[model samples]
Target chain A: DQQVKQNSPSLSVQEGRISILNCDYTNSMFDYFLWYKKYPAEGPTFLISISSIKDKNEDGRFTVFLNKSAKHLSLHIVPSQPGDSAVYFCAAQLKYNFNKFYFGSGTKLNVKP
Target chain B: DVKVTQSSRYLVKRTGEKVFLECVQDMDHENMFWYRQDPGLGLRLIYFSYDVKMKEKGDIPEGYSVSREKKERFSLILESASTNQTSMYLCASSPGGGFNEKLFFGSGTQLSVL
Candidate 1:
């Protein structure tokens, strides 16, 4: 069973608009969530992360909101640029198992200019 | 920057043949991982090592094995390659085995089995 799920396979947005991606997890033990961005033929890179203790975490144009009650998290990019087009993956780690991570299928984001 | 380098970007192997995929990291990280990326399946961990000569199985380690004789190096071994094993293999490294540590990944190695 997939502990983490990104239901949206793809998303499209216009440049300078707000792009939002959503993710849900089934494991209540997961205390940390992370977002990774990947381009074609390239490995994924860390984007942003949030801890269960915090409701929101922001870095520059990126913001991650966590709702522990719903077991959901979302990533928002303000003024989305064409360069931001890539596959976004949401991953979660169990609080006790630090070495193992569970990843979602990923959503392909297309920011149109 | 943390540079995790895979020895090969692409490889073609015959079924039943033994295959070895090598990975090296510039950072002196204590944790290394092997994962396979497939459409719909996302990235599934095959194996990981916390330190030299130490290894552990991940979610999908049925036909795969890993070796970590050195701290900076981790190798994934396919004892008997099969067509089903064809996929993008990724190697990653982290400073420590912690939920807070963000992973650094290699570009990836696409292995094709005939």
Candidate 2:
């Protein structure tokens, strides 16, 4: 069973528009959520993260929202650019198990310029 | 910046051959992991090591083995490579004793079993 799920396989948005990627988790034990971005021929890089204690966390143009009640989280990018097109993965971790992480299948975001 | 390095960017091995993928980290982190990425299945954890000579199996460890004789190096071994095992292999490292520590990943090694 997949603890983390990104139902959307792909997303398309126009440049300078808002792009939102969604993820859901089944396990309530997960207390931390993170987003990673991967480009062609490269490993994934950390984007942003949010703790379960807070509802939202923002960094520059990226914002991560966590809804503990629904076991859902989302990544929002404002004014999306062409360079932002890549595979985005949502990951979660249980507070007790810091070494293990659960990752989603990933969503490919395409920004049209 | 923490750097995780995988030995090869691409590898081709014959079926039933023994394959070894090497990974090393420069950050002196205590945790290392091996994962394989498939098109639709995403990333599946194969194995992880928290300390020298200690390893644990992850979500998917079948047909795979790991070795961590030293603190900075971790190796994934395929006892008998099969065509189905052909995928992108990634190595990651993270510091110990932290809650939700970020993982530093290598460039990944694409292994093809013919």
Clashing pairs in 1: none
lDDT of 2 by residue, B3-113 (tens): 999999999999999999999999899999999999877778999999999999999999999999999999999999999999999999999879969888899999999
- What candidate 1 gets wrong by more than 4 Å, as runs, is none
Model 2: runs farther than 4 Å from truth?
A: none
DockQ of 1: 0.77
Interface RMSD (Å), every candidate = 1.1, 0.9
lDDT of 2 by residue, A61-96 (tens): 999999999999999999899999999999999989
Please tell me which predicted candidate would have the highest lDDT against the true structure: 1
Q: What is the lDDT for B25 in model 2?
A: 99
